[model samples]
Target: MSAYAEITYEVEDRIATVTLNRPEARNGYTIRMADELGDAMDRADRDEDVRVVILTGNGKDFSVGADLTQGGFDFDPETGPDAAWQEPAGRCSKRIFTMNKPVIAALRGAAVGGGVTITLSCDYRLASTDSRFGFVFVRRGIYPEGASAWFLPRLVGMGTALDWMISGRVFGAEEAKTAGLVHSVHEPEEVLGKARELAREIAATTSPVSVAVTRQLLYRMASAESPFPVHELDSRLIGGLGSSPDAVEGVVSFLQKRPPEFSMRVDTDQPAYLPWLNK
Candidate 1:
């Protein structure tokens, strides 16, 4: 929002594209890049006109990990939340995690260390056939950032997560798909195009408020230990649909064989009764 130097944010046709802008260094990870990315995601989430977000890097490789040439990460344990301190990658990934809008990550070439970790919270990941991914923290003598340890296990299972994190080795697109890390694989030239196509489809058909609710439910409720709480929440949501204009529009449009015109906005129409909002 405040003149981003490390990333670019653009919104068109209801899709916000946030691209990593450091092409000269293969979009290397940096503190400034992390802050810019977090700001971009927050901007997209709050904009009613933006229904979907597509995240991709500018050049051939998504990112070659950190820019060691500029000297690696330096952190101070004494830095507090009020101070100018936040873990680099989590600032971006955590912002994406809280977003009501769906996010799709488009990857090509290498996505290693901080690169792949930052995208772990995205709802979907579409990578090029030549794309390679890694959690190379151990090899680099630094531990993982971005809360990837939590996200990675949920995505690829404990076994695969352990294998990748402990070994610190890179894997290709096919293996990423097989492990459920990436949703789909595409040609390098077609990956971003495919992401845009998917974003358009989501923006055109789905109810914004419904997608927002569903996104939160999947990320929060699905991980709960008890199904009773989910059932209670689901019943409440279903009951509220009777009073929802968008719900009526959905059914009427279907009967008329036309595109649904949902009037509910994600920013204002999301139900305030949600129990997880405070936490």
Candidate 2:
């Protein structure tokens, strides 16, 4: 019943797995795939049963970047870059940035250009020993897209982002992990399994509403100008959750030596001041 054309979405337990299905083409990023990815992200965010999402490819490569086989001169002659052509990777990245559930990118092979930028928006990335990454936009006679200019610097620092982007060179998974681009690296066939295990761990241990609010707060406050605003937000959240049912259950369960079964649902129980209006 899934409407996706280039991706496969399957939900098991509390984890939603979104797989890029274009293996023959190395899971290249295309307009249709971008739209579908955004849709899949929305689905995961809206589904209360889905606590986490894992993004991976159906083939050897996570993604080889954009598909160029559409031939040259495909852009509108009159509008050019200003044409209504929104960058596909940007669409997917934007959705991931705002998702309620955490996303983990599982990379096995090549992740170039759009490939690298799209994953940059995810909360965590796990790669295989055989994985490779490239920021080859400059080499392709273009600059980085998918808001990578902002994401890359925030992730690996300005100097590292500039060096890799300027050089447009391919790098291995170990280098990426050392640069703070990825959380962990495992054997090729174990990459997706490891990602799933992590997702399950989070889903099992965390409260959905708390996780959603905390994720937004962390990402939003990361670029804030001052700590005062974050303190205010923290106070507001704590005041709201302090006496809630989940809070009581969490404390009681700990005292009794048992797992806490939080009763609040994110959809209806989220604090009124959530999302930080100014952010």
Considering every candidate listed, which one attains the maximal lDDT?
1
The CA-based lDDT of model 1 is what? 0.91
lDDT of each: 0.91, 0.88
lDDT of 1 by residue, 80-105 (tens): 35556667888888889989999999
Per-residue CA lDDT of model 2 for 1-279, tens digit only, reads: 268778999999889999999999999888778889999998998899999999999989999999877443336657676646677788899889988799999999999988879999898999999999999988989979999998998899999999999999999999999999999999999999999999988987778888888888888888889899889888887877666888888788889988878888877887876665334
Total backbone collisions, model 1: 0
Which residue pairs show collisions in model 2? none
In the predicted model 1, the residue pairs found to clash are none
